[model samples]
Target chain A: MNRYVKLVNFELGRFMKVYIALIGITIISQLAAVIVVSKSYLNNANQAMNVDHMAIETFIEQYGRMSFNDVTNSIFFIGPIALCIVTLLIYSLFIWYRDWFGKNTFIYRLLMLPTARLNVYLAKASAIFLFVLGLVGLQILLLPLERMILQWMVPIDLRWDLSINEMIRNFDRLGIMLPYSIAEFAIHYGIGFMAVIVLFTIIMFERCYRLKGILLGIGYGALALIVFFLPVFVQEFMLYNYFYPEELFMLMLVTGLLVTAGSIWMSNHLLTRKIRV
Target chain B: MIEVKDITKKFGRKQVLRGVTFTAAKGEITCLIGINGVGKTTILNAIMALTPINSGQILIDGAKINKKSYEKITFIPDAITMLPQMTIGQSMQFMQDFYESWNQERATELLGFFKLKPEEKISSLSKGNTAKVNLLLGLALDVDYLLMDEPFSGIDIFSREQIAEVFTSHLVEDRGVIITTHEINDIEHLIDQVILLDDGIVVKAFNSEEIRENEGKSVVDVMREVYQQ
Candidate 1:
């Protein structure tokens, strides 16, 4: 743990500038999304309230008749996500190429790091998670700011609600253990998300034949198909949601174990020890 | 201690290493010299366990280096392209972070000696400085064996001298370094053993002093005769 932490901190320190730049871009793009959503909502409100019936109907009729080609605008919505990926890629490439070890290629150099190859894989995976977490946190913090900006830009009563919070209140009447459910979902998605990243990281470092990598990927897909049937399998094996918590826990445990095993094999065998032939 | 017996490597139909055999004791600088395409680097790769041999085995200190023995040795290959966009500082952080044997103080001191500021991105550093940083990494590692492939081939005279000084200075007891290079002048005085490869085979593997005494020639001259060029 100490060793891996040191490695990640080192990696992050090295590319601090690139990371900061990426965060800046993401914030700007997200803010742009908020502005566009706010304007559209205001336009909808004006028509629904019938404040300017003739003018609003004329505007709506014109827009409704026109074929709204939104390919360009759709591309605009992709800016934040696209920036995240491209920035991470550029930063990863930079670190791989400019590393200290004297080697011919980035993949080979990474393989030759003295740690368990899994640590290298995990460090990058952790970085991706942290990046996403920070973005989500910022969005939550800035959503109120988004509401304020909307009020200034349009006449509608500006209001905001925490999406997850509101949903929790709505579900309180059912006594459905919403908190527990959210926790389970978080655990499930987080493991699954890291697993997906680990799979990619492993695929990138795999020195085996292309066919072998494909086979490994195919094998992973096959296992995923089995996991997808977990709830169904559980349903048929016993009864509906019988031992629900235990079943969920066991499902998570199994997925977590597979991901861990995959990470280790990729790290120890393929990542570090695989030849760059 | 490092040992290779009857090891061979083939890239498709072309054999890169053919039935090679050699050994190096602790605290020795063994120079691997050969003509281009004679597979000097291939042997180094095999010894480092970076490239697996098609036929034989390599025992580092009597233990076969496999997937588990990465800590026993650190490899310094020629022309690193691992992370190009990071500055010296970031690379240092990575090296310091991952390897248990990493010597951060030595790395920092060497950075100063090489006159490389941490702020300078490795992509912007000159080829000579890049080589200097490479040598520094090998020197800083507190491992038993350090295998460097052509440590000074593309570097300049001053940088070569600096690298040689760093290599010799770091050869404490119980440490071994094997280097492959055409520039014999850079290491002739410091090299403990000379292993010459001809067509992926060890044509000559002996002490540096013996080659000087028997052939009455410099290491470069011996290589010229051995390669028949």
Candidate 2:
């Protein structure tokens, strides 16, 4: 177990500089989101008279009640776009062309540490998990800023009472205190997002062959289709439309762990057979 | 010490290594030589626990070399295989963090000796320089056994000489070193043992001193005789 930690630390250490840059980008993006949302809230608040408080509150609630489908679509769309752009700029242009990214030899070189391949996989997976968690934490921090942005955008007549601290206090009331611990509502969604990456990291080894890359992408789509409707398929597709937050978190965590396991399992299994570079 | 028994590996019905068996003693250099596609690299990879054998057992110091054995052995392939997106410095740091045997000071000194800039990405290095880095990595490891595949291929004569000197400086007693290469002239003086591999079978295994004393021939000559049968 201790050896595993060292391997993971080393795995993450390889990308420490890049991770630092990633965190900076995340902070900046969250700050922007906060500003944008806060301005929008403020603008809407200015238009409403005192008598229309209830009406405006209703409006905000109705508008903000984004369905799971909405959130999933919004978040997943960001996944590929963000990843591609970042990888292209950071890795393809700077690392690939320059030959600085050692991931091309990740399996043969990096994974061959004086430890188990399972441990190596877990370490890298942990680093990615932490990377995504850091972004979510920053996003949570920017919530009040977003509220401020909303007000700035609309200049509503209603008086502002909630400071960023109060809103965060409400979050604490909701559950959990540490920045690392996400809102209960978000743990599933965030973990699911990460699980997809874990699965890809393992299956992406197929990139050694052009055909395999396409096949893996398609495979990802297929697995997503199955995971999306798994509850429906197991219990009853029509009745199980809604997801329980705790249940969802549990399911997402399990699937993430399984896929994480599968990723290492597949990598180790396939490597035993001598796959492509 | 290492021993392999009843090992067979087939790649899609093509039997590359068929029921091959061999033993390598501690603190001795065991050179495996064979023609291309004859499973020379496969055997080395298998022994190093990089590749899995179809049906066999590999024992290292009486303990099987499995995921458990990985923490002790380091395999250096024939080519300079590293993440092209890293500097020699970053690579050294990574190795140092993971392996107990990694010596950072030796790594830095060797990097300087090779004239490779720490900032230079591996992609920019010439093939010879790449090979130098690969050898540098192997030499910097403070391990019990070092397995190198074709360490001298494609390297310039002068660089090979320098690398040889580096290896000589780093070689410690009771620390096994196994290197495979067809370029016998480059490493002829350094080898202590010869394990002649032909058609994936160990036809001859000799102590270098004994061969030189009794047979009165270099490894190249002895290698020719072992394969002649």
Candidate 3:
């Protein structure tokens, strides 16, 4: 196939092991979490009604029904999701560093490839993006299955059922992960894509420069952050309620495009011109 | 042909290559001989554009180095270029995937020549075998020019001998080679030209046979006189 695709495949292959492990962990842990939380709720109900000799009505009155919120808040549920996110963040940085700082100098081979050096950068960015989307998709597919398990363990009266959409709308993290509509999806993932691009650029800065580049990288990151949020600041303070919400979104989209283009250009320059093997 | 003109490179405050200049013509082996840490590897790196040069220019076949020029030249680094987890076969596949000029036939031949198993992981190979795999990767590429950084730096006696044998074999025929090494004794007779580097400067660059014939002294003899003086 094409060099870009090949590079992407190579990059994906590089991180496939860790990515699979993260997926396995998420599935196993979340399922176990649902089971544990459901059982715990049942046990509490049993103790109050049977052991304490309290009426079932009194127990029902005292303890509210177990809801989607309680199921999600359990360590087994949110804990694995949080773990996956944190691990992916660490892997994002590790992906860049492994080529250079790892035992073998794999960057030499990558840089020497006959393709335009930017393919390497884009390939890496694409791999990270692919991984993020894969995990999100997995979480999305898991919700209905999780709901089925909740229904199986907790009785109808004692459990509060919520559809996936309602759950996402209620929970902030889920909402971010799974946006309500197309426009919101685009906005949310657009921001995520930009963040990845900017992060890769900052990594390029550090890779090209070394100890001194760390400060330059951090400074560059702060500059990018300012540029990205500039339209918001303008709308709020400088414009004094001049633009509508849609207008602000258009400005932000334009800003995001400009920053992404700039990031790609700068990353290419560093990869081709300044980066040392 | 590969021509490096007045290339200068620096790492932070320290100057690694200072106005370095040299050339390696096609069908010739140019040996860049120097002591350790004298920017021998840096010069090779600059020629291949693996690392940036602060000033000066590098040209391959009378044109500046670029993505297209890379197709004509290959670098076999002193250190392992493939990931430690990758098998020799996987590494070859990786090379074959990116490079249009990659010759699987040559790679297979070298794999047999070096007696390296294709399925062996890079990390499992001995230093000498790893060096052989590195050489195999470079030699397999059907490129006009090859830049090798210390192919014989720290290998066992047998692997070094195997690598040295490839210089005379048909595997490297008609390919321009620029090799950097502080230990010159290994490939002394194999080299066509010698470039002596001292403190990032090209102290001397001359035909190896010419120096031996006209000056009636070995490269080591000349090195002693130049370095001691």
Top-scoring candidate (DockQ): 3
lDDT score of residue B179 within candidate 2: 75
lDDT rank order: 3, 1, 2
What is the C-alpha lDDT profile of model 1 across A1-277, one tens digit per residue? 5766865665666666766777777667656765676567566656654665646446545443111111113344347656766666564434433442344455555656665666766776566556555655664465456545545665432333334444334433211322336675476556646555555544544344345666775676566556645656677686776657687777657766666566556545654455443
lDDT of 1: 0.65
Model 2 lDDT per residue over A1-277, tens place: 3777776575566666876776666555544544444544455544442445657556555454211122112333234326533543343223212221343345566446666655654565565555555555655565555565445544343334455545544444212322333464465544544554445443444433335555774675567557644654544566564666567556656665665455556655554443433
Candidate 2: TM-score?
0.69
Q: How well does chain B match by TM-score in each candidate? A: 0.92, 0.91, 0.97
Off by over 4 Å in 1: A13-22, A36-113, A151-180, A201-205, A210-256, A259-263, A275-277, B65-72, B89-119, B165-174, B214-225
Candidates' DockQ values?
0.46, 0.34, 0.84
Question: Mind giving the per-residue lDDT tens digits that candidate 1 earns over B95-195?
Answer: 76666778888888888888888888878889999887767766677788888878788778898888777765644345887888876776789888988
Give per-residue CA lDDT, model 2, range B6-122, as digits (tens): 688876568888777877777777777776677878877788766657788877888876554555667788766567777887778767776677888878888888888888898
Better of 1 and 3 by DockQ: 3
Candidate 3 lDDT score at position A75: 78
